[model samples]
Target: MNKDSAQTALLWIVAAGFFMQSLDTTIVNTALPSIANSLHVAPLAMQPIIIAYTLTMAMLTPASGWLADRFGTRRVYFVAILIFVLGSICCASAHTLGQLVIARVLQGVGGSMLLPIGRLAVLRSVSGEQYVSALAFISVAGQLGPIAGPTLGGWFVQDMTWHWIFLINVPIGAVGLYAVRRFLPTHGETQAPPFDFVGCGLLSLCMIAFSLSIEAPFSTHRAAWAAGLFVLAVVSALAYIPYARRRRNPLFKLALFSEPNFSVGLIGNLVCRIGSSAVPFLVPLLLQLQLGYSPLHSGLMMLPAALAGTVAKRWIAPLIRRYGYDTFLLVNTLIVGSSIVAFALITRGTPLAIEIAILAVFGAANSMQFAAMNSVTLKDLSHEDAGSGNSLFSMVQMLAIGLGVSIGGGLVNLFSAQWGSAALGFRFSFACVGVITLVSAWIFRQLDVAPAQPKVRAPATHSAGR
Candidate 1:
């Protein structure tokens, strides 16, 4: 009984890591305006701050598993926490936008490693019977991070300075460091592969070039620079395809794409996310920039969504089970997409109560879409494929998020220039995002009527070394 209790405590600690990771993603959104004002940058130009962190994480995520396997998981996990805490401190102290962006990159390096390593730890340490429960706990906390982040960020920004948003991680990260160093285990016997530096470099270049090109066209008024970046992205992507094929062990293991479901799921996720992913970024910007809401009030507005999300989780699994993966994805995708449209249509005169209700509904549907889509993507992969598949999926998710900010932000700017109104531009951009999401539902049509449900696999024998 004591052993079981100890095991539960360790899992909870890992969940905390997951919580911090997701919290970091949303917490900064509400604070973006304040941070921009303090840093002397325009509010719209701040998308890069958000993009840089997620883009860095996406670029680095493909290697996280291999690193954990090569070095001991516990060691990598500890280093991740250390970097994360240090990075958080740097962000809090940063005096300029450039400094904060660089600090965020540092933080992303750690953030990229946190959940993947923690999830691997849970998979190794928890018994098979407990796998579902363990995952369920982590998912709940991680999801709550985004749900509560805006609210918490708004509260902090209103009550204190935006720097405190990053500072809050210092204490939490310190505790996590202690817990991880003490309780996380080592995988001592595994054969570690050589680091795939060439592939990693090529891949990172490709992602950076692609994401930057998307932003450059909208951010700066330099058409030549934007064109040059676009050309670079195209060249970099082509360069990686052949490089991945020729190598003995490529960074992505391109062979994995042969699986129909995995390929479709990944592309679907990337394309779909372009529309939905930027909502968090846009929501706070809308509330603060156009809606005339205070940071604290905007943050408070997010509470209902987060609270509703908690309640909505109970229904996701059942709906997916009853309707199957394809149906759930198709239907839920529409719900989420339509909600973004609804948000876009919101105007200054929209009743506060109505706006809050709208945000809450979008939050609930979106939370469901995440669970269902994530599970579906992994449902068919074999045990050997699970780790790589999941890692790749995570990389894609982050990359799309970065792209979403750039694409959504760029599009909004474009529409603003054409419409000659920032508010109208935001409206057009939201509608565009909605249309993009609506189109992605067709990807789900590829799935069979009785789509296979991804079952939670049992973890093998598992430990806390310290």
Candidate 2:
């Protein structure tokens, strides 16, 4: 093929990888109830399936760039697609929750690499002048994934079976593999620096421990296990400070946190997301199990939120320009938090229009929240620190998603057991997560209040981080 044709084909390959990765993130959510029924487990008990995948992705994401540099992008990208497909097969064949969770971890290993490596490939293959447009083109796939994932997953579960939700990846991945081999440029391996294995391990241990602590309520020795894990998480996090200081090329330097906005934005992102991230997982289950909606209906119900979020993106730059990041994030964070709390008001008797309005408002506000948070976090980093800072931010984003599921799921279980009503449990859970989100507004308040300047768009990495 000609050079132009090859580049176009490469874009298609990368976009497909992104679509597959983003789709998997939300697709299984709609199918969770069905999968739970088939596997003879409670629907809410399936958080581990989601948590395992996201947490594994969080643990492995920092290594993706290094891997792509060490191994050729073409080779690693091809293998990523292969592993994802195989993991999907395993998910489809699983007979138990443990099996499904294990399969998801395998899937996460592949997914962790897809966007980072695919972006790396694009950087190498596409000309710099066209890079922004290239990323914009690929970002459509990322946006479409969340928009399509829930609806598609719901349709599969309702019309066919939950297995199809996973099995569907096989054909797409097959095409991706072929395209990767044929179109993706073979920029052979570069001489990468030695990876900070110790730093990576410490961070990974911290994330794992913290996530498990949230999940410990489900274990036999709940209190003891929770205490121990929380301690371990703290210790691991503390240990990383000294390790990174001593190492020549650590995973992430402490200097990145010296920037006021970066520190504030990073903390706000984690805390706010812990509450907001649970909505996607919790909303579908509430529709299906409590409200008696069909899986497809639940999935379709997510359309207002996703579409509203899309439409709201155009409003972000203008709003932020007028209010600045501090004012915008501060006010928007409350709106987002209140919108989440509003979910508590949803009931079997509530009007459908009101529910749709609530979802739309939350969707719009949440979308703006993500963009502002990301921009403010990385906006002040030096050129030398941008790469590491972005990677660390990406890791936190994934880690928050995992923790959100764990906390959301655990709250439901806790409240349900105490209240003796599943409906009340859902209501209370929503309230608690809303409060968690509300607290993050305080973090955003820490940003320096200055007049808005010309719009500074966040890097294309924001697209993949979503």
Candidate 3:
């Protein structure tokens, strides 16, 4: 019993790391406008602050597992916390937009390592019987971050200063650093094969090009620059395929996608997330700029969606079990997409209650879609593929978020130019992205009637993207 209790306490340490990483991802969104004003940059140009963090994470995530195996988990985890805390300090002290973006990149370097390595620690230490419960416990911390991040960010911006958003991590990270040294076990390094630096470079380049292209549409050389970047991005991504195929031990083996569902599921996830991820970034701006909502009020408005998403978790398993992954995902995708479209209709005169209801529906459906999609994508992977598959999925998830923000922001700017109104720009952008989401439903339709559910019991296990 004491041993079990000790393990449980250790899980809390892991959860704290997850919480800090997840919180930083979201906590800055509501504060973006305030941060821009403080830095003397336009609000729209601030997407790079958000993109830089997720993009850096995507670039570095593939190596996280290897780092833990090559070095001891405890040492690497301690350094990760140290770097993250120091990065937070840099972010608070940054005087210009370029300095802030650089700080975020540093923070992402640490954030990229935190959850995956912490998860590896838990998986190595805990028994199979205890794994699900331990993971579920840690995931609750991740979930709570989304719930608390916006509210905390808004309050800090309103009551104090935008810098407090980053400064708040100092104390939490300090305690986490100490806990890592005290409670974390000194595990032996694995005799894993040599790391694949070449493949990693190719994939990293691909992600950078693709992410940059999406943001190019908003630049001064909009058409020509976007075309050049788009072509380069395609070439780089395609280059990785042949390079991976020729390598002895690639970063992610091509065979992992032999299962039809995994391939389609991944493609669908990337496409669908490109639309859904933008809503969080765009919604706050819309509320503040068009609807005349305050930062605090906009943050509070997010509560209905986040709370409804939490409440909607229970509905997922039963629905999937009864209807199967294919039916559930197909139907749920439409609901999620349409709800996004419905947001385009919210004008200054729209009832607050009605707007909340629309957001709640989108939240519930999107949450359910993610859980189902994640399960189907990985449910078929063998134990050997589990680690790499999870890492690849995570990389794609972050990359999609960066792409989503870029695309949404670019589209808004484009439409704003055409319509001569930022409000109309937001409305048009929502509709276009919503349609993009709806098209992804066809990918889910390709799944077999009875799809495999993931063995991992926590509903949130597959929700790494969230």
Candidate 4:
């Protein structure tokens, strides 16, 4: 093919990879109840399915860049598609929750590389002038995944079977594999720096320990295991400090924290997302299990939130410019938190219009919150630190998502058992998570009030394996 044709084909290839990855990130949420039934597990007990995939992605994301550089992008991308396809087949074939969780982990292993490597491929191939537009084009595919995932999952679960939620990826992955081999350029491997495997392990351990601790409430020996894991998490986190400091090329430089906004924004992102991330996981269950909505209806209800979030993205820059990061994040965080809390009031008696409005308002505020948080966190990073800082930020974002689901599911399980009502449990879970989000407002308050500079990079939106 000609140069222009090759580049265009490359874009299509990468976009397809992105669509597959992003689609899987959300496609399983609406199918959880069905899958739980199939696997003979409680619906609330299914958080591990989501947690396994997200946490695996979180743990492996930092390695994706290194792997791409060590191996050629085309080779790695091809392998990634192959593994993802295999994982999807395994998921469809799973008869037990254990088998499904293992399959999801395999899927996460591939997903963890897809977007990062795909973006890297585009960066190498596309001209600098066209880079932003190319990314914007790819991002549309990412956005469409979340928008289409739930409804598609619902339709499959209702009309066919929950297995199709995963089976659907087989055709997409087949096409992606063909495209990768045929269209993607062999960029050839470059010698990369020694990866900070130890540092990465420590951080990954910290995240895993913490997540497992949250999940321990469901275990028979909850207290002892939870305490031990929580302590392990804290110790693992502390161990990384001196370890990173001594290394010539650490996983992430501690100096990145010197930027006031970076520190505040990172903390706020972690804390705030712990609440908001649970909404996607919890809302579907709330609609179907508690409110008696069908799978399709539950999935359809998510449309308002997703659409509102898309529309609200355009408003983020203007609002931040007007109010400054400190003011914008503080106020927007409250709105987001309030919106999450308001879900507690949702019930069969609640008007459909009122529920839709709540979803829309939450969607807008949460979208702005992510954009503003991401921009402020990375805005001040020096050129030298930008890449590492961004990688660490992405890892934390995925970690937060896993934690949110773990905590949300744990809370519901705990509360339902105690309160003897699943409905009350869902309400209490919303309230708890909402309060967690509200606490982040204090973190955002620490940002010095200054005129908001235009974002140096696009706000990191949720993608499959970001």
User: How should the candidates be ordered by lDDT, best one leading?
Assistant: 2, 4, 3, 1
lDDT of prediction 3: 0.84
Candidate 1: tens digits of C-alpha lDDT, residues 22-135: 888889989988998988887877887888898888878777778888887888888998998899999999998889889999999998888778877788888999887887
Using all chains and alpha carbons, the TM-scores for the candidates as numbered come to 0.92, 0.98, 0.96, 0.97
Q: Write the residue-wise lDDT of candidate 3 on 1-466 in tens digits.
A: 3767768767988899889888887788888888989999877788898899998988888888788898889989998989999999999999999999999999999988888888889988899998977888888888888888888888998889999999999999999988888788787688868999988887888888878877876766487887887788788778878988898899999888887877887899899998988999998888887898888888888888888888898888878877788888889999989999898999999998999999899888987877777788877778898767877887888888888899888888989999999988999999988998999999889876483443423222213436
Alpha-carbon lDDT, every model: 0.79, 0.89, 0.84, 0.87
Per-model tally of clashing residue pairs:
0, 0, 0, 0
> What range of 10 consecutive residues in model 4 has the weakest lDDT sum?
457-466
Better of 3 and 4 by TM-score: 4
Residue range 414-436, candidate 4, lDDT tens digits: 88889999999999999999999
Candidate with the greatest lDDT versus the true structure: 2
- For model 3, the stretches where C-alpha displacement exceeds 4 angstroms are 449-465
TM-score for predicted model 1 compared with the true structure: 0.92
